[model samples]
Target: MKKFALYSLFAMASFSSLAHAESVLSFGVDPTFPPFESKTANGNLVGFDIDLGNAICQHLKMKCVWVETAYDSIIPALDAKKFDAVLSAMSINEKRKAQVDFSDMLYNTPSVLVAKKGSNLQPTVDSLKGKTIGVAQGTTQEAYAKGEWQGKGVDVVSYQNQDFVNQDLISGRVDATLTDSATATAGFLNTPQGKDFAFSGKPLTDTHYLGEGAAIALRKGDADRVKMINSALAQMHKDGTYQMLEKKYFTFDVYNKKP
Candidate 1:
């Protein structure tokens, strides 16, 4: 009887340790995008996505760990087990769907062109002909520009992150940059460094490139974790937690009404 009790205690302790290990959810993020994920002056991650990820973890009783990753190589890193899921503002496109699974729609925003005021530049092959456009590496904007404008006399330059793209745009190395409207507004255009720039054209709506919306990305075949996150997201929506976080960052609803 004593030996059996001791074995039971050891088994329970081992199971508890395994459960605790499994309860930690690691999220990969590219901290360069503002209003979503970025580091404060003290290197603490702060933004809407960061808050949302923490809320989800709290709701699910899991520990959340953020791993900084480059935007272009985020997917590969996810597959390599560097992190369990990607909590960055990654879009849900067919190309990406083929590589990794994504949670339900988080939010949707339009992509627009930012150029110097009165430049009269538009996001078109003809309007931007012979002009240089900067885009972040591995972004849908990069894919769209490369596919639609690269060979049509438009010079599309790719940067490792959006911050670099915006920097070059300010320096006149690129005439314009195509990026999400929210980031373009909050991260650059609304700041003093981007005072000279303005949205140049109508938002791009090519679903083939712009994608459906942004969501948390997980490795393929991880349906259980995907369902868990989806459930947490649904709960966040139902309990008004999603709106609370959204109000913290944006004035309008970032989560699209349709999705």
Candidate 2:
């Protein structure tokens, strides 16, 4: 009788576990930042984030569904539960922490100022005074530029996305742009239109604006989901899955400089 009772309990527990399992996890991505998230000619989303998100879902035994969002509205959409979490290249800063919780730091990259090789525009308030600088809307670079340089006569223009900023930079629409160095290197500087552009000055770091590093953004108070995602990320690091994805996109370490 005890053996029969034990067997029944085990079956009930197994059924309970299966009932609570999440079958589909929808991720929000901006699809603007290449090497992180972007779309192909066939309209398929691909990048490091896409791969990592899929891996995380695989570990959780869930299907990964990506939802395309604008850079500016992503957080708001998450707040409204339009998607389960944000897997875009979103930096984790205090300002954002107030809006959403973040998983362990997934990666970090330096901010840089990109300009034409001969433009002689340095990334300093005094040097960029009276010059128009471009930055993606709703990004840390935008906040940094507006806070540090806008009042000093620097024209900090906000674009809808990084690709547009790169486009204007190539056409000389703006004197320069402030963006991720790795992104500029891989997505722009290496491209034909960006061949004439070069990054000037050292990497920009701001504790207040730039924050610690990029991570997965989740709705506030979703502790279960947060724990699951963090564990999956740690497992990926331990099993070399993170390294495998990193090798696909970049040569340098993007997961350092924890905040």
Cα lDDT of all candidates, in order? 0.90, 0.87
List model 1 lDDT by residue over 1-259, tens digit each. Answer: 9999997787555545543669898999999888898898999999889999999888878899999999999999999999999998898888999999999999998889999999999899999999999999989999999999999899999999999998999899999999988888778887999999999989997878888989999999887678778878999999999999999889887888332
Give per-residue lDDT, candidate 2, residue 10. Answer: 75
How large is the C-alpha RMSD of every model relative to the true structure?
A: 6.7, 5.0
Residues 1-259 of candidate 2 have per-residue lDDT tens digits of 9999997787555534542675788999999888788899999999889999999987767889999999899999999999999999899889999999999999998799999897777789989998999999989999999999998999999999999998888787899999987788888888898888899877888878887889999999886677778878988999999999999999888878842
The pairs that clash in candidate 2 are none
Predicted structure with the largest lDDT when compared to the true one:
1
The lowest-lDDT stretch of 10 consecutive residues in candidate 1 is 11-20
Estimate the overall C-alpha local distance difference test score of candidate 1.
0.90
Error of 1 at 119 (Å): 0.7
